[model samples]
Target: MEAHHSEIRILKEIAELLNEGTEINGLLSEVLAKLLHVTGLSSGWIFLVEPDGKHMLAAKENLPHALAYNDCEPMCTGDCWCLDRYNNGRLQKATNIIECKRIESALAMKREDTNGLTHHATIPLRAGNEKFGILNVGAPNKTHFEPEELALLESIAFQIGTALKRIKLIEVEQETALTAERNRLARDLHDSVSQLLFSLRLTARGGAEMTADKETKETFTYIQDLAQEALSEMRALIWQLRPRGLENGITSALLDYGQMLGLKVEPEVSGVISLPGKVEEALWRIGQEALANCKKHSGQEKVLLRLSMEAHQVEMLISDCGNGFYYDDKQGEIPTLGLQSMKKRAEHLKGQFKLKSSPDKGTTIQIIIPV
Candidate 1:
């Protein structure tokens, strides 16, 4: 009876944590810590698997030195029994994996401390037919888990899985709403501000052509030029919101945008154009920014854009042979807001950004993103 009550208390605390509605990462970390405290487990971690079968270490608590080495590099990558079983649809419940492959490898290498941990209980987190990922909990010298322990873990895993599904649905709905708003704004800009700018430019041109006085004609010409510049800027903004040509592919869309900016875009693409939606969107935005920068800053009218696709990653390079300013690479600082924005877009997708520039040698921007 006492053990059953303890289990109930654990469930109650965990249920409360799940109900707190915190961010997923923070909620998972807090729940893992709470579980460890109540169950006396030495360490625990959670993996959130994407629909494409890629798994990420969502949360961890009290990792042993062996697995925590190199910034937990071991845990972040590589395949093990639990993951293999999970991927194969065999890990349906809480059970003890034969042994922790990561720990075994760490021990064999003798590079970092394992703190005597050799085994763990792996629980598949699922809600109905949907499988989110796995929850792993273990302790020093605890090679196997009892039935009661596994049952408790299974119950908690169910709650976590349901919460994950709810959160993901919410995210999808929010994204859909945001996309709708962007389209609406783009339409409004095209119909209102864009048309007004075009009309203003036409009126200024007519005034310049009709005026008799030289000074009045010059003033009208200046107005016409300013209106034309504003119209170009407005068109760029509208394109960013809608990205009308993106349906075909990122490369094609980028080529069209570069042409719109009056730059000679020399594009070289390798491998298939298929990419994840988020990655494709990010790359498209980054490419647009790079091309816009080339048109505005680079003295040359031509730019080279290269896209390479590999099994695990994609690379994009944009370069121009123009009068370039000296860039101080030693400090690793981005000199312009445009570059900073591009860097942030790449990093937000867990990718890399590199920039190189020198006087008379021109500038090169490279971005690599894992898909």
Candidate 2:
């Protein structure tokens, strides 16, 4: 069985890649490419479950049309019939989707690009009771999968599922370690540095008030002011490290942060501020990032923040009336790293994120996440 030998080789390659800590996207792409090559399939794709559990994210796809068209990804924009069924809990194993509704429907509309694609098979990537996502492989005008081929595909899917689980575990471990380190640093700063700074400020103030000589009094006054500023900065740093009152809610914590930053943050609320812990945490981090960006680049201290909660969703908007960048510029023309990071944070929560900006107009950042 040359085919069996090839399958084993592919699995080994994937295992080696995992050991090297290859990113999930790259790992999926390589695995899909290898599987398509070995099985002589027309195309393949991988869909991973997002954090929200309500949406399936199209992680990687290698298709003939996409490759021919410079990797155009329509799959990322719309959901296909196969995915619809999968989301509805119909997909449980390696199963053939006869006359894939997506491809067939496209063919019916005389879309020439979908030619020869009649069906595909979906294999659920799962680890026992935990299901992660799906691995899909399609053939040209093929409506069924052979038993042996299906078995090999299932085996590959299982391997992928185990790898995904391992990656998830690694991420959780890293995040836990990071949080613990932050707490330790926060405690040290608050108990040692902050207290010392407070004492120094008080002593400097007393010395300045009691001094008789003009020059000596001025020197003590300067020291008192410097120590006071240092204490304030230290408290701000500690707040960031371990966000005090975050457990109570984000509203109060954000207001306090704005006060620390010497910014007039106008808040507008529409509904209940209650939210899940993860949702609150994401919002807190996003708020911090947005405020930091404003302080660094906005050229204005006042900012407007709005939080709205509807029956099924939560929305946040942070706007600043300051110098804005050109949003209509072509690729590589605009600074996008921060914007991309904020968008990623929202997407990680299965939310919609947008930034609006113009040369003279101000910038507005908005995120709407379904609860």
Candidate 3:
């Protein structure tokens, strides 16, 4: 009865994790971590085929509290035995670590190549016809993984691996769609606004001799300057329209957005919280909105943008020296589209976002989210 109850409880927890709005890594980490608790293993992890197919991404277990993916680095293609099996399409296990000689040998090569990994069991992880990566179990004790334990780990890996593959495919589709939209926007800018700017410049230069009165000449010059300023803004927009590829992970996106977001207020930027591009894009959008508000309504000369990883979540804070306002005071009162968009974005991520400001004080926004 006791054993049966434990199994039931474990399944419930697994189900809950699956239902949560966690990314692939988080879900897998939970599955593996629970299995480790039940089987009494020291450590476990999930791995995935690096998107480029050149190496493997050492994924984390979906535990309640654990290491961030950025804190964990992946092994190279030729270095991981797990990747070799995943690439070669095979699931391997070694009972007593010694009995699994062939796999252990391959793993040892990987270990030497990686400098070393703690003792572990390498199981090929997959979904349908595709191989994701591998599930590995590690313990300080040499004889920690028995045949039964290995079987359980492999079973867990099977289910988790399949789910991971599905999630990753969805992510790819999203990224592709985003890239297409960005490119389409870029084309529109280049064809329409860019062409218009060129024409305006030419027209201004050609008509320079049309007016000889000093005031008339000054008016024409002012119009030309306005056109030039409009052109500059359009050029910046065009740069953003060029979609960054999948290779630009969360850290890269954060860095890129930091520069752009800080341009107006010249905020002090620090620490980078890196995740996938999707997460980064969301963060960047929120940052963009915050900076826009600061410039438009906050009446502040400078703002601060900070990004960092704390516990299992990513944190971003944007504060400016301006009259502070209550977050809910104008909840249904003011109809600012930019602030609405930022709040909506935070809600979408299952995160928390807040804005505190006053009429004569300053504004501070803090956004906390899980990656």
Candidate 4:
């Protein structure tokens, strides 16, 4: 009766956490530890399956040091047996996985960090047919789970699955709204601002050609040039707001953008350029900002963009042979020319970003994101 009451309390606390809008990561960490404690389980971990279905991102893990501290289980890894089974559609319910292969492998290799974890259980975290990932719990002394314990574990897994499904649905709705807004903005820019700019440029040019006085004509010509520049900038903005060529790929879209800006940007590519839609969108925005910065500050028309895709990562480099900032430049301190935005985009993708600048030297921005 006491154990049952403790389990009920744990479930109530977890439900509160979920209802209170705790982020998935924090919720998982807190709930896993609480569940392990309430159920008297040794340890536990959770995995979140990526949208691609090919990768399972390690969400949270709390375990004894022998299994946790080793290279075999360093928080997260792609080479997980449970994840492989989940991906292959073999695991669809709370099932008993006799032993952790990683521990066995480590023991076989005589690794010092090997644990005496001989058995564990895996519960498929799911809401109806929509599967999220797996909830795994270690057994106390490698003991078997009683029928009641298994039922309780399944109940907790169901709670986790429902929470994850709610979060996933919210994310989907948010993305849908965002995409709709982007389309509307793009349409507005194209139909309104872009047209006005084009009309202004044409009027300015016509006035410049008809004016009899040389001074008046020169002023009109200057206005015409300014209008032309504004029109170009507007087009670039519209392109970014609604990318059409991106349907082909990011490289093609970027090349098209460079052409629109009247600048020759040659992007050297290695390996296949394929990425998740969100990731591609981020890169596009970052690339647009980088190019805009170069045009507004670098005073150079031509630049080099390099994109390299590797086994587990993608790298991007934008370099320009133009006037760069000095060593003691205040620009870096001030986050000038959308550099902060670029950095944020990279960070959002869990990537590394760097910018190099020096007086009389070229500027280069490098970004690396793991796939």
Quick one: best lDDT, which candidate? 1
RMSD of 4: 5.6
RMSD in Å for candidate 3, one decimal? 14.3
> Worst ten-residue run, lDDT, model 2?
64-73
* lDDT scores of the candidates, listed in order: 0.90, 0.77, 0.61, 0.77
Model 2 C-alpha lDDT per residue in residues 106-167, reported as the tens digit of each score: 56666677646667898888888788777878877788898878888898888888888888
Tens digit of lDDT per residue, candidate 3, span 104-152? 5545554433222245677766666666666666654444566655665
Better of 2 and 3 by lDDT: 2
How high is each candidate's TM-score?
0.86, 0.77, 0.49, 0.70
Where does model 2 exceed 4 Å of error?
1-22, 40-42, 49-62, 66-70, 109-115, 259-278, 289-305, 310-312, 318-365
Superposition TM-score, candidate 4 onto the true structure: 0.70
Q: Write the per-residue lDDT of candidate 1 for residues 1-371, one digit (tens) a residue.
A: 99999999999999898888647899899999998998999999999886557899999999998898789899999998998899988888998655889999998897558887899999999999999999999998998898888999999999999988888788778877887899999999999999999999999999999999999999999999999999999999988998988999999899999999999999999988788877888899999999998888888999999999997789999999997879987888999998999999999888999999998999999999988
Q: Tell me how many clashing residue pairs each candidate has.
A: 0, 0, 15, 0
Model 3, residue 261: distance off in Å is 7.9
Per-residue error for 366 in candidate 1, Å, reads 2.4
In model 3, what lDDT does residue 116 have?
A: 29
- Residue 314 lDDT, candidate 3, scale 0-100: 84
For candidate 2, give the lDDT of residue 347.
Answer: 84
